[model samples]
Target: MSGCMSSSDESDVSACNHEDQGDASPMEIPADDLATSDEDEEASNPPPTKKQKTLESKKPKTPSQIKKSTVKVGGKCSSTNCSKKALQGGHCFEHGGGYKCSEEGCTKQAKVRGKCVPHSGGNRCTQPDCTKLARLKGLCIAHGGANVCSFQNCTKTVQSKGKCIDHGGGKKCSKRGCHNQVVSDKLCFEHGGGN
Candidate 1:
């Protein structure tokens, strides 16, 4: 057989002269010949340019380098004692971090001024004459706070209803026509009641 092979199977074969054989089976070149051809191709090609060699030698930046690049130069937490990076509104997530209550002396986190719920700080009663903290309804206990007795004109604190035990709010005397409150017995102290 002639050393020349068909073009279809050996289109990449630059070192061989293969004549076109229409619809012929592909020729299998020896492994040693293939290696020699590869070596010859490498020798013929020019070496990489200086810039290409430099780019190939360069490595990707390390994690520390990336972190340093992202670090802020002068940015810091708003809190005087804090040294951490500021995440929002010039403050760290730990010290005065989130949105704070607009009320004076209140450090609670709040979305709006009206809805600022006190977490640790106490809110003053809405009553102008009161200086105590408000428990509910914007007023202290003396100024119509929550959890008061449900009885009319009753200002005492409550166990359940708005009325104190003395005002028939809790368990009352079992005796007929007796409105006195009871202790542990079904009757009051005046009605032979004792626990």
Candidate 2:
């Protein structure tokens, strides 16, 4: 025959002239050539069935797509004794590594609206006549956001060990014969302690 052959006989007998016959039935393809041609045809054309489309979509992504989908995990800040994650520079916000206040001559880290808390930035306390920054539930630390001193008749915030700074709960100066609170470098300001 001039065209490809299609048979429904019991014996394995088939002939397909793919070059001459542009539109031949898949059943006319020889058994040996079907495996390779089937894969190539599927890859070149979109899947016809919904199940086939879903299966095709589940294939592994290309290298470029994989790179775009990956998330970059941040490392710890490089500042001394700081355990927070690094943001912009090598240090944490408290160690002068984040966005600084936009106001001139201000070096404090910006918490909201590109300005520090003292410069009318960040969420304010919900309590009346209180302008301090909110710590929890829109309330400042002084307004029940934090724990108070355990000492009797004391309303100050707890500094350390359930006690306020006045109750000797804060870090003290490292110098001999000094009981003052540490300002920097484990020493009081009076002992030339400034960062």
Identify the leading candidate in terms of TM-score. 2
Tens digits of per-residue lDDT, candidate 1, 56-109, equal 323222222222223232245545666554433444435433354445665444
lDDT of candidate 2 vs native?
0.63
Q: Rate the local accuracy (lDDT) of all candidates.
A: 0.55, 0.63
Q: Each prediction's TM-score against the native? A: 0.26, 0.38
Residue 105, model 1: Cα distance from true site in angstroms: 28
1-195 per-residue lDDT for model 2 (tens digits): 333345454232333433454567544766678898888988999657998755633333222222221211134455466555544444455544456666777766666777778994678899999998998789999888778889999998877999887787898889988876775578764674542
Which window of ten consecutive residues has the lowest lDDT sum in model 1?
Answer: 60-69
- List ranges where model 2 is wrong by over 4 Å: 1-100, 103-113, 118-121
Scored against the true structure, residue 167 in model 1 reaches a CA lDDT of 66
